[model samples]
Target: MIRVSASGVNRPDVLQRKGAYPAPAGASDLPGLEVSGVVEGGDAAAMADAGLHIGQRVVALVSGGGYAQYCAAPAGQCLPAPEGWSDAEAASLPETVFTVWSNVFERGRLQAGETLLIQGGSSGIGVTAIQLAKAAGATVIVTAGSDAKCAACLALGADHAINYRSQDFAAEVLRLTDNRGVDVVLDMVAGDYVEKEVGVLAEDGRLVIIAVQGGVQSAINAGLVLRKRLTITGSTLRARSVAFKSALAKACQAAVWPWIAQGKVKPVLYRTFAAGDAAQAHALMESNAHIGKIVLTWGDV
Candidate 1:
């Protein structure tokens, strides 16, 4: 159990609220996936693995139930909050960081000296990706809906930012890389965007898709994929097993936590609302006007 201080709002939460996405079997039907709070009780083995003490302030990724003052989470999915972070900031870390680590580093296999192209770079996931990829020694490129959003991504250490509304991202990526193309593409938009992303990869590139914000059906040219030796794959975080998330938690601690500690990467919190106004939080998220993360706060912090 955790005495919840704050909860991170995510796109999936909005979908779940509208009855578009259902919780996995046996998981909570509540609309949150991550929280920050004090530990109360959980499996001893998991607590040991996560190095969590009963009173420790920590952030955790959960399947649901983060809207309340007290919630339960798997111990293996928890991590110590970074020093000097507010409850709101700490609450913002788990979902975005976990997603970035699993998809960008673990799945995409992005390495130092490689280039990464991120779709929707002003988002919670996008901000995390830009910082993490840059901290890992990769050149970062991103696309956002507006010029201001593009500028925000560039300010966050993206090497280049394309306003997707006024610019052709594929062409810009090619131009930026001198036609060599990026080595990895972290994509949230699927459907037609998938084909465009495939067109912007270098030989032996990887494309890791984490969301289908556009549409679900996508068409790709098999010949291009074959010629480029590209890999296309994607995963959703909520349905994975406890052991799987536990492994990911360990990996994030090893690879990503240092960056946070060193101040090389940090959470970008847009706004926080009282827990009673969760609907407003979701509305802001759906509006797509805010940058970084939206959080809901409980008073105990």
Candidate 2:
């Protein structure tokens, strides 16, 4: 067992709570993907047998059941918490960091000096992607719904922040890139943006879609994709197998954890609510006014 200090609230959690994403066989019905806590008992002996400390502070990715005082997780999914970091900050890292690292770097094959256009720039995944891409020497462009949200993305090292509500993102992206277009487009808006995303892709550009918040189905321009040699792919972290998530966790620890520890990257926490107020926390996430992460804190910490 582990004492959950903080649990990050994400969109899937809200979806699960609302009966959108059903819990898999034998998984917890509670809606949480990541958590921070101290090891207490149960698997503690097993972890120790594998050379892990019993009372060590750690952060982990869970498929479900994170919004409680105690969460049972496999030891393989855990990583040591950055020294001196708050539980809220540690709690915020696993989901966003792992998602960004996997989708933006490993799968998208985004390289240094390339230009990346990120949708939903103020979101947990967006904020984390902006920081990581910028740190790795990429030019980052982001789209958000409000001026304040755009400014927040810019403050987090985005080279350009477009207010999607005020301007056409595709036109703005084209203007910013001088028609050459971006090397990668990390999109969460999958409705009408699909054709536009394809239109804005550079030669051999990769478009990785991680969510469909706008709408699920959209018509695509096959001609634009064929002409641009674009590649479009999408993934969800929650439905992935344990081995995949464990590999992702290891990759995140190797690539981004050091930067976090050195203060080059940090968790952007929007708000914190008590564990009992999980419903309120999910409601806050649904509001879409938060800049980064919303967390539910548990225990005395």
TM-score of each: 0.98, 0.96
Best by lDDT: 1
lDDT of 1 by residue, 142-231 (tens): 999999999899999999999999988899999999999999999999989999888989999999999988999999988889999999
User: Candidate 2, 190: how far from true, in Å?
Assistant: 0.3
lDDT of 1: 0.92
Error in Å for residue 192 of model 1: 0.7
Q: TM-score of predicted model 1?
A: 0.98
How accurate locally is residue 163 in candidate 2, as Cα lDDT from 0 to 100? Answer: 96
Pairs that collide in candidate 1 are: none
Indicate the TM-score of model 2: 0.96
Residue by residue across 1-301, what tens digits does model 2's lDDT show?
6688999888888888788899877778878989999977666565864345768899988988888888987777788988878999889988898899889998899999999999999999999999999888899999999999999999889999999999999999999999999999999989889888988889999999999988988888898888888899878888788788877877888889878877879889999988888888888888898999999898643
